[model samples]
Target chain A: MTAALMDGTAVARRSLDDTRTRVSAYRETTGRTPRLATVLVGDDPASHTYVRMKVNRCRQVGIDSLRRDLPAESTTAQVVATVDELVADESVDGILVQHPMPGHIDERAVFDAISRGKDVDGVTANAFLDMANGHEETFASCTPAGIVALLDAYDVPLSGKHVVVIGRSSILGKPAALMLLGRDATVTICHSKTRGLAQFVSEADIVVAAVGRPELIRGEWIKPGAVVIDAGYNEGNVGDVAFGPAAERARLITPVPGGVGPMTIAMLLAQTVSAAEQRES
Target chain B: MTAALMDGTAVARRSLDDTRTRVSAYRETTGRTPRLATVLVGDDPASHTYVRMKVNRCRQVGIDSLRRDLPAESTTAQVVATVDELVADESVDGILVQHPMPGHIDERAVFDAISRGKDVDGVTANAFLDMANGHEETFASCTPAGIVALLDAYDVPLSGKHVVVIGRSSILGKPAALMLLGRDATVTICHSKTRGLAQFVSEADIVVAAVGRPELIRGEWIKPGAVVIDAGYNEGNVGDVAFGPAAERARLITPVPGGVGPMTIAMLLAQTVSAAEQRES
Candidate 1:
């Protein structure tokens, strides 16, 4: 039997609808739209496109957007200062710094500078720790959170599953493993240094590939009935798992372009609304 | 041939001796002994004994000790304030707060209040995140760090090995998994919520049991010829794994009291010296 697809576009549309309703209520009560600050550094074509999409989505959901464009030559201190200003601004309910900010700039230092209250992207170490520790007060990294939401929406029970996460990146693999663990799954995290990757994948009841290596995980490597969630968006929108073969073996699979990518922006919007509500409360 | 036993007592003695020599050098250079503040709340007899043992160990290593005893009636805020004072004190090189401090107290909040620099025990969320993210700048929890040292001392190569960690406690299982991952081991973290725990253990090349459930892991659960590191210390000093059967089958195994217990204090002393050195630098 062919694997059932996890439709990210559909899920995102539903989430955006919910966000629009929440924004309307928030505006009615406060006489102002919820505001989110989007900071984009450097002119990386992909980064620009992603930021533009997010800003446009904000307007669609009735959230006011604040844009900060910084040059590629910006110093770490200057970026941090700008983020600090946004943190202190009363009108800004959420803040997101688009990724791949310049090789010389310390991205973590800048991400940490964003106030936890306004960390809509949940890139800070504190936010990750809170998610790992199962603390109630935490905003998870958007992509991982979105993946979990997709899994739940599809009625895939995580409890007792052997989930082998192939990759350990901060935004995807690491947080996804923690999120699965939170749901009672027996989680194994594999990365560049991991040995016998195929053996681990073959034994897994669920496989999540976020290694960003296109077709690195072969279909034959997957357990026949395991669920597959491919979050990798590499060159040509390819995923870490070899989709055609993996799809044949997986009981459920999420296609690259239609899967985790759309859900990420959906979570960002949902979290922005949540942040706004929390601020008002 | 029987497996060689990992003797924690012997290793701890050597470690303590090394710490003593370092402490002497620090005292001669700085004209002050390294000091660690030990905080205890309520009158849990076991906790009291543990703190006293730690204090005596500090004295043995030429490290000064400061004791703070609070009544069981202390509120979470009160405990946090006490920890905050220690965090701000330049005289305190490290702070060790005895665990299971009253049900009413929010232990996590108190742990977070300890300055990350002075959190030699590595209980703070910041430290855990650092460990998880493979960042070099955070102190590892004492027991987990001690386990890594034990493996290194024994010349066990973790790279490319399947290391199954049985437990999810922030102090032991989680940090141990992170440490093994850092060393290139394919790490799996299991806990009470995990299904088929024995199956996971049976496949591991290295197994670490820190669940604190007395003999919960059966002997047959271990993979034949696997290295077993028992970090559990339950009532009567029993470990999580059934030692008798596991020892018979495993290639190397650590005894209950003589396994990971003594190493905990040894790591604490080593970290305290490191903390003193850092402060000097």
Candidate 2:
């Protein structure tokens, strides 16, 4: 039986619509639009594309956006200084620093420089700590937050369900696992060092593929009728899961391009608006 | 087959000896002893006993100790004010605010008040964030740090091993799971809300029982030859595991009173001394 699509596009649309309303209300009440400041380093075409998409979404929701573009050879101090400027800017409601800055730049130092209050993209260590402690008022990393939103949108019951997340990146897999655990799902985190990965996959009631390896998770490894959320976007629109075969075996599945991607931007816009409201009120 | 004991008491002794050397060396070089300040908010007998033990250990290692005991009726602001004093005190190298402060007190606010550099107990959001990001220079929560020390002392091969952790506490279970994951272990976190707990436990190469319930992990649930670390300290000197029965099946196991308890104190001392040295240098 072919599995039903989770249709993240539809869910993200609804979420963005809600964000638009919130943004309009805030603007009308305060006579000032909420603003998001983005820091993008280097000329990585893909990174630029991602930032542009976020900016466009901000505009669509009536939130103002500003960009800080730095050279590829910029030092860690430079990136951090830029973030500090955003932190001190009274008009900026939220701050987003695009990931994978450069090899020479200390990413953690730059991330930690973002003030916790303005950390809309939730890359700061404080954000991770707050999220781990199950603080609802704090923002979560966009991709993981989006994954949870998709799961909730589909009415999946996470309590006591076994979820195996195949990746351990701090931003993606780790936070995703923690968020699922918060929802009372028994969470397992698997990585490249994990032995017998297929064995672990077979036991999961829900599988989250975020490893960024194209088709790394074989469809046959998925437990029959298990729910699948593919958070990977690799070359040529491929996902970590072999979607065709996975869709045939899964009860519910999220497609790559339209699934996690759109939801991520939607969450970012919604969080930015929330950050503004929180600060204003 | 009878399982070998992990002997945390012996491991802690060796660790404490190293701390003593470092403490003495620092005292000799700087003409000042390292110091740890303990902030005990209430008069809970158990908490007092725990803090007293820590203070005594500090004396044994040649580190100075100070205490701030607040009333049980103290407000969150009072406790936070006390912590804020320790944070600003240049003489205090490390600060520890005992857990389970009166329910009325805001524990997180108290923890956040301790400066990151002086948070030897590692309860601050900064410490958790640093540990989550695999920052070794940052202090980890004492119990989780001790658990890793025990694993290393036994020469347990964690890489690629499946470790099932039976709790999700910020200090004990969650950090322990993340530390093991940093060491390349595939980690599963099961909690009170978990279903089929036995199935998860039976598959583990290493089992960490951090749930406070006595004998919650049964002998029958243990896989043959799996290493078990029970971090639970419950009523009547019993552990989370049924040791008598579990030891009969496990390859290596830590007993209740002599196991995780001492290692925790040892880690606290080591980290306190490290903080002092870092500050002095």
Candidate 3:
């Protein structure tokens, strides 16, 4: 492979190490562990796995995990009330509601209910706006932050780069574009409505694929020597970009399993520790 | 002059006519005129003209105008406090603080202080998030809304189009991208940090120039037959795009003076009426 591999696992491990030191210092000073409340709605196997991964990572990083698993039939009001209770709980420093909630539940309302200070997941509108406006408070969404960290670790400076982000969903595409803009990179977000997807990607110095469509971005569409960060973890562990051809052209490329996925949990842990520090302070 | 003029004045006039009817109905039902508070800090000649134009449009549309002129020495807290009072005032339907506040003032804090319900100018972070997320909200920024209205009037469908927005300012570029995304247009925001500005523009089906830098975007940069909306009204009335060359290539182009300027005030009035109606409802 001519393209240098952007190892998300290695970066995440470093981040976890840093977070561990911070957690230790925080615990020594405050005599308490930083706590994260994870709310999982429904029994989707993937969702359960993701939550378990996060909770286990939190334990390894010396943070407390409070898990709330709701049944599939949980009402919007019940979910919101549970989130609100977490918002008010003094013991919980951060709250994260795993994605793909039951079809009936109002996800926006639930995300909005989490206190902005304790919104470690950074899914709330407030956090999105804060990130968009260059005033990130408390936390940033893990995937977006991880993408930026990956770029930084690879020494891919975003300043003056044309960053074409393929997606507009709040969690990944939107926050990723905002973070890129914050770094002074000119960002363009392409979604389903985008007429010419390949054309935009072809011109990008940095391309971020978070659209969740497997291999939607063709390898030939990538600009020569551009840095490509694939945030897409699609079915069968695939990514948005067709890696085989893209890696041949890209100067630096992130692989599916070892790229964005690991960094996400790392950022979550870092933010959780930061939240704890804020509470203790 | 082969390029068809995007007559912002004519379009704005139509919008005002619609807004007038809406205002009449709102006044008839509410027994009160739609109130828009205009807060101007310092004596910027251009800012003065913009505010006067808006106030005049308010009178023409049968909406009430609340003008608050502060000195150049006004502190950030003072401006924020004034906005806070307006937010609390039930009589005020919308509050607009003219941009480019004195160098010392923290403008973001002042804008955020305006209650989201009364944020007709759509400067608040909360209002932006609301617009981006498709949540029903009070209003959008006048210029961005005007851009949408202009495109809609011209039968420009945003869905599935590559929209290259060349700016990242809160009121213009950022909000414009968000609004376009809300419309399902794949939006890419480019600014100083973008490496290949011309390449991005050339790939765009619709190019929106909101960057304040005069003639920053060259005519050759435009894609042939693209719809060009120049929101940039910079020094000496120059636009961000090189008008002459861009006009030759563009299928539709909005001129500097007669384009986005007039439409901005029109949308402000329209949203002001909507805010009033919302209050009454």
**Cα lDDT listed for each candidate:** 0.90, 0.91, 0.88
Off-target runs (Cα >4 Å) in candidate 3 are A41-45, A68-81, B40-49, B68-85, B100-106, B134-136
Give the TM-score of chain A in candidate 2: 0.96
Any residue pairs clashing in model 3, and if so which?
A160-B193, A160-B195, A187-B189, A188-B188, A193-B160
Give the docking tier of candidate 1.
Answer: medium
- Which has the greatest lDDT? 2
Over 4 Å off, model 1: none
Cα lDDT tens digits, model 1, B1-281, are: 36789888898999999999999999999998899999999999999999999999999988999999999999999999999999888899999999989999999889989887788898887788888877867678999989998888788889989999999876678779888888889999999988888889999999999898999999988888899999998989899989999988898899989988899999998898899899999
DockQ, per-model, please?
0.75, 0.84, 0.66
Measured over all alpha carbons after superposition, the RMSD of each candidate to the real structure, in angstroms, is 1.7, 1.8, 2.8
In model 2, which regions exceed 4 Å deviation? A71-78, B73-75
Give me the displacement of residue B20 in model 3, in angstroms.
1.0
Question: What C-alpha lDDT, on a 0 to 100 scale, does residue A271 get in candidate 3?
Answer: 90
Can you give the lDDT of residue B167 in candidate 2? 95
> What would the TM-scores of all predictions be?
0.96, 0.96, 0.90
- TM (B chain), model 1: 0.95
lDDT of 3 at A191: 82
Candidate 2 lands at a TM-score of 0.96
